[model samples]
Target: MTSYDPQKIIDIHAHLHSDLPSDPALRVKALESLLVEQGLVDPAAIDAWIDLYAEEIGPKRGAHVVARAWTDPAFKAKLLADGTAAIREFDYQGHATGHLIAVENTDTVHNVVVCTLCSCYPFSLLGMSPGWYKAAEYRARVVREPRAVLKEFGVALGEEVEIRVWDSTSELRYLVVPQRPEGTDGLDAAALAALVTRNSMIGTDLLKARA
Candidate 1:
């Protein structure tokens, strides 16, 4: 228990290498070399893991949703009215199952998304929510008032553009479906799709067609 205790040295050594091996693949190799891979964790099992790791973690599959809306009007409407069902149509599922709403972003009325009921993100497909987006400040400001929040995010809207704030419920999570910007006339669907970011799809920003 004195200063000579080996535990203190061990702790210091641990902290020294804490930030090492950031790459998961390298970590796996280290684990294998240390002979701790057995009964430790199956590398293949980790590979088999789908997007499950991203739970309420990311943008809630917003990019895919926006791409669909820009290309298919019917699909967009279906998604806006009933996100769960529309997502199922695309063979995607996980979280926010029972109730969901996808707001349509238009030039006149820009939409930004947030979940005040707890970060009910759809990470099974979207990956992970940005730390700033899932923060308490963003949640509170986005709910109490959205236009101001957007301004803070550097998203300025003119007086003619109305800002709509959407609240996310436990049963129903919402994502922003921003409108497609002009000037991308010749670009194909694939190129257009590339322009759709998860944030834009979730109404956090607008998509500028491949220009």
Candidate 2:
């Protein structure tokens, strides 16, 4: 217990949604497989559950949570202070670790998330990342000098905004929930969600609700 390194664990997934098990068969099957995989169920239910999920629900189901943060500042603070709850505000909640801090990509700092060795992301908010973000070139250079890497990504910020690079260590994971652009005050939730792209949440792009 004394030498426990909590930052050693991280989950970088494409998406995480509760809508995965919509049908009765799919729900039962998914539940069964999850139970067994976690050592919570017996072997008898594994095969049948798999078959049922495949036939009933089809593919894996997951939801995105970044959109909600884009519309609400108080919610955004909640997200920075409590990531799991902030994600839950939209639906696809994630694992609650030691702590989570959300840095807004304003006209000052552009935030990006990466695991130098592996992929680490906030699946609940941004969905899956593109192959480019997970590439070796991105992982290494992005951390050492973020501004340079972002320039390669077609992001050339002026002196107004600072480019900040954060390393998502093993114990704690970070999510870059970009700030809503200056003039997007009137956009509704649904309209705002469309702008909260995976990259925007990762701070690779600006979150623009209006042109």
Candidate achieving the largest lDDT: 1
Off by over 4 Å in 2: 1-64, 95-99
**TM-scores, each model vs. reference:** 0.67, 0.63
- Which candidate achieves the best TM-score against the true structure? 1
lDDT, model 1: 0.69
Steric clash pairs (candidate 1): 57-128, 57-129, 58-128, 58-129, 176-201, 176-202, 176-203
Q: Rate the local accuracy (lDDT) of all candidates.
A: 0.69, 0.63
Give stretches of model 1 more than 4 Å off.
1-61
Candidate 2, residue 123: the lDDT equals 47
Alpha carbon deviation, residue 183, candidate 1 (Å): 1.3
Q: What is the lDDT of residue 100 in candidate 2?
A: 57
List model 1 lDDT by residue over 1-211, tens digit each. Answer: 4699789899988985796577889976887656544677665666555434544334434565567777887987788778888888766667555566777766698877677767766654466667877789988888676777777766778899887876666566666676677876666556666777776755666566553
